[model samples]
Target: MPLVDKLLILAIGAQVFLAIAILVLMGRERVPRVMSGEIPVADIAVERSGYPLKARLLSNSFDNQFQLPVLFFVGALLLLQLGFVSWVDVLLAWLFVALRIAHAAIHVTSNDVPRRFAAYSAGLAVLTLFWLWLLIRILLVPSA
Candidate 1:
């Protein structure tokens, strides 16, 4: 596997970890509330709590994993399928993964909108550039 492909796999792993973290946090927050009769079982899916702030943050972060990260996954796989490996590609892939981790940290901790948006924007820019590079390679470079 190419380095870029490995980075994409790590990125996907990060998302999976985030999802599991969300589930754990949700149960921690909800189970106590339910036992206290503060909320009904049917309302569990509604994503609210007497202290809903953390749960909402986790939910939002989990949802973000399926967004631009999808493009990152697809772009990486396309490059691998076409055998377009390059150091630049690997660098950008790592950048996207780092920025995504920072984004999640900001989101789940401080919940600062501006900081979170900046991190997400930086990651998106890296991913977009990766796609553009892949397109140029596919369209212009002669395959060996």
Candidate 2:
């Protein structure tokens, strides 16, 4: 397998870890209820003391992180199939992962909305760059 493929797999693993962390944090007996479903809000509030605001925000950040990896995986596959692997691709992929981890850490620990937002914005920028690079490469490079 190629290095990019390895990186992509690693990205998926990181996402899974983030998801599990979110689950565990919510399991803590202090998280609040914000979802609506068959389970009553009161029941949720009672069952779990409910998460701190920071925990909830961190979970949401992880959710976003979880989604980005899927998109990156698809983009990576497409790029590899097309035979174009650049530093930008690798850097952007890893950048997204790093930013997300940092975002989750800041959010969970300090409820630092501004810092978290900055990290999220950086991740978004990387994703946008990936898409643009893919588009440009596909259009400018001749098909095999």
Candidate 3:
């Protein structure tokens, strides 16, 4: 496989693994509480108000995996499909993933808004550049 393809695989794998880890962490917190009738099924079913802070933190972090990274996923596939892969693109992609992991770590641990926002903003900026760079590259290239 090409290096870009490998990067995409690792990126996807990382997101998947993170999601699974969050699920396990949530299960650790949720199962006992639910089984003990501490949190009603209705509350969890309707909304997360019933979930405690720890579960909420993990849940929010899990939710983030689906957010901005969606663009990364799409952009990655586009890059592969269009054969527009470059070292700069790969570096930005890795940076985005790393920042997102940092954001999730802070969110689930300290729930620190300032630090989380810094990581999130940086990742968002990188994602924006990723897309903008891809778009510029596509527009600059003449169709065969």
Q: Which candidate is the best by TM-score?
A: 3
What is the per-residue lDDT of model 1 for residues 1-144, given as tens digits with 9 covering 90 to 100? Answer: 766567656755765676677668767866787788777766765545444677677767778878887887788778777778677887887788889889988988998899999999999898889889988888898657
Model 2 quality (TM-score): 0.70
Q: What is each predicted model's overall lDDT from 0 to 1?
A: 0.78, 0.70, 0.88
Could you give candidate 2's per-residue lDDT for residues 36-122 as a string of tens digits? 343456644644324545555655655665576677768877877766777678777777778777877887787677997898788
**What is the per-residue lDDT of model 3 for residues 3-108, given as tens digits with 9 covering 90 to 100?**
8778766876786687788889988988999999998898899788799999999988888889998888899889989888888888888888889889989999
Pairs of residues at least 3 apart in sequence or in different chains that clash in candidate 2? 30-49, 30-50, 30-51, 31-50, 31-51, 32-50, 32-51
Off by over 4 Å in 3: none
Off by over 4 Å in 2: 29-41, 45-55, 66-70, 80-83
Clashing residue pairs in candidate 3 are none
Provide C-alpha RMSD values for all models, in order. Answer: 2.7, 5.1, 1.3
The TM-scores of all predictions, comma-separated, are 0.80, 0.70, 0.92
Pairs of residues clashing in candidate 1: none
